[model samples]
Target: MTAPDDLLRGVEATLFAATEPLRADEISRHLGGADVRPALAALTEHYAGRGIHLVERGGRWHFQTAPDLAHLLRREKEDVRRLSRAATEALAIIAYHEPVSRAEIEAIRGVQTAKGTLDVLMEAGWVRIAGRREVPGRPTIYSTTPAFLTHFGLSSRGDLPGIGELRAAGLLDPVDEAYAVLTGSGEDAADDGDEDGAGAD
Candidate 1:
């Protein structure tokens, strides 16, 4: 029960020629009203363990070099642009509570979010302008983009890590950890021996 050879070839060619990933309907339209599911599945199976993998990320199908072979294709070292603490916090807030306005982000962060912080996230393609909120001022709102899910290897927002996972990973701030301990909500954090006079400051 394999797909037709011509259909598979068309799908493969379309994906390879695409500058970006395409949705199933887009692929179907490109192939002139053909149901491309079988072709895609067959291609996925055929490309398994090959130099390039036919993968679906964020509901868009595209071919990418196999993970193990990626380094071999790199001609030079990539410039690593590390995110600042402000940008990281803003990204997390956008991911967790999307379609949020700038005011909302600031309110949750308890600090004024600098425009540059969000500009970096947008430049990275993880955050996007969702639209203006429906209010008197109509403050601009933001949301995580499909690129965010793809980069994070998440199928959807529901796949984001939970608070318990963050706590277990020691990502929760000291303030939250202390409150958890005080309320008997979590285990005590370990002393890394650098805290002898830490509170003295």
Candidate 2:
């Protein structure tokens, strides 16, 4: 008979190999239920003292490399990507409160974002249109992309750094504070002079 311990090792291997966080249902399907809990617990406990740790968030599970290893990883290559104050704010709003409309973004920002703002994010492959809102005149909604998670070295959106983390890093630039003083409604909601204006594509 296969030992529950071996079954758990299999579960742990599967979990560790996944690039994205796995839902419990998916994990359970991979490991037979009778030994699933014991396997999961054993794997979790086994990695407790290691450089990597299994983490659960937003009902999904994944392994995260330890923060202590960050500096060491940095030595492997030069980090090149750095977001500007406005870019960071726009990204944050999209990430935390996704499927948000441009109008909503303007409201939070308190001033209009330039045309290039969303374009830049999209160009970087970090943001995309989630879908159009089901309201009158249905506006297109935007949300962070999986590429955003990968670029940030996060296994999922839940791993996004909080306000406290930003403040601690001394990288918290209050882009919104300046928005309250601006006059553009915090959105570039103007018509693009398209011949088929108001037509949904």
lDDT of each: 0.74, 0.65
Say which candidate scores most in lDDT.
Answer: 1
Judge candidate 1 against the unseen true structure and give its global Cα lDDT, from 0 to 1: 0.74
The digit string of per-residue lDDT tens for model 2 on 2-43 reads 787677777787787887777777877776644465666777
For all predicted structures, in order, the TM-scores are 0.75, 0.62
lDDT of 1 by residue, 43-151 (tens): 9999998998998877888888888997898768633655544556667778778898877877776777777778878998889999998889888999988777766
Worst 10 residues of 2 by lDDT: 192-201
Q: Which window of 10 residues has the lowest lDDT sum in candidate 1? A: 192-201
- Candidate 1 stretches with Cα past 4 Å from truth are 1-3, 73-80, 167-201
C-alpha positional error of residue 10 in candidate 2 after TM-score superposition, expressed in Å? 1.0
Off-target runs (Cα >4 Å) in candidate 2 are: 32-38, 75-78, 114-116, 119-128, 144-201
- In candidate 2, which residue pairs clash? 111-186, 112-186, 112-187
